[model samples]
Target: MNRRDELAANLADVRGRIDRACAAAGRDSAEVTLLAVTKTFPAADVALLADLGLTEFAENRDQEAGAKVAEFAALRPGAAVRWHMVGSLQRNKARSVVGWADQVDSVDSERLADALARASGEHPLDVLIQVSVDGDPKRGGHPLPDLPRLADHVARKGELVLRGVMTVAPLGMSPQQAFDALHGAVTRLRDDHPDANVISAGMSGDLEDAISCGSTCVRVGTALLGSRRLASP
Candidate 1:
């Protein structure tokens, strides 16, 4: 099949999965946003996906995403696409990231938040606190206990807007268990910042579990774009 045709089929199938999962969870499918992670994929695919009706796309690396964003804009000048940074971001990359990303879903430290805020300039940048379900720093998330302070830090930044929380299910725990813990964190996060309602959990593997446990966004990559191409040596 041609790439567009393949993407069309994959997009349909993934949306079907989201619908079924939402139905099973007794939630509206519209409540969940499908964020396609376009990392490692070429910008052409991004344009094709946009034609396929996807609006939000994410990338893991600033270098790849920076080029892709510019290429996509050239491909479709007026396309309404929202780019997101969903990977572990270094503070040094903050300035460049703000130039391209519409939102960032991996703010796990005050230092990172401070960097992003400083680079955000006049426009307030939207960010989600990454919570470590198991409190493992290696996995790139703020421990549950420290999230409130982090959230407060983000909230206090005039250039940053606290949007919500995001987390990957730690290897040791089931997606359901991790999402349950995330749901609790989101609940507490909302107490002080009611607008911080986004729960960006799940991917291709465990979106169903995330939906059941109240995930507002799912960052899907492989299932939508097929396996990623490895970098050339």
Candidate 2:
């Protein structure tokens, strides 16, 4: 099969998994939004996915994503594609990110939040507080105690909107456990900011577990786009 055929099959398979996961969780399938992570893939792939009805796309690197965003807009003119920044973002790159990303899913610190708020243009940028489910400093997320402060900062900032919380299940821990912790965080966030309801958890590997624990968005890459080709040196 050609690349397009492969992508179509992969997407259908991923959708099936999502459907089964939602059924097992007794949640409405519509409740979960699949975010196609197109990092490392080219604009052509993104355009094809757009044709396949995926409106949301995520990327981790600002440099690559910025170019892809512009390329996608040029390639698929007038298409409503929501760009998301799902990787750790540096303060210096905040302005660049705000240029294209509609939502940033990895605001893990007040400093980063401040930078994003400053960089955001007249329109407020939708954001999710990245929570460190395991408190792993290497993984880049705010600890549980820091979430409230960060969330408060985002909500108070005129340029940024607190959409919800996001997390990656730490290595070695069960996805259920990690996502359950995230669910707790989301509950607390909603108590103060009722509109902050998005829970971005899960990826291609453990989406079922994430759904079982109340993930509203799943960031999928490999399963949808196939194994990533290593970046050229």
Per-residue lDDT, model 1, residue 232, is 20
Q: Candidate 1: minimum summed lDDT over ten consecutive residues — where? A: 224-233
Question: How does each model score on TM-score?
Answer: 0.98, 0.97
Assess the local accuracy of residue 44 in candidate 2 as a C-alpha lDDT between 0 and 100: 88
Candidate 2 residue lDDT tens string, 56-80: 9999999998888888888899998
**Which digits, one per residue and each the tens of the lDDT, describe model 1 over residues 1-233?**
99999999999999999999999989999999999998888888989999999999999899988888998999999999999999999999999999999999999999999999999999999999989989876788899888899998899999999999999999999999999988987898898999999999999999999999999999999999998884221
Model 1: per-residue Cα lDDT at residue 133: 89
Please report how far candidate 1 places residue 224 from its true position, in Å. 0.4
Q: What lDDT does candidate 1 reach at residue 32?
A: 98
Pick out the ten consecutive residues of candidate 2 with the lowest summed lDDT: 224-233
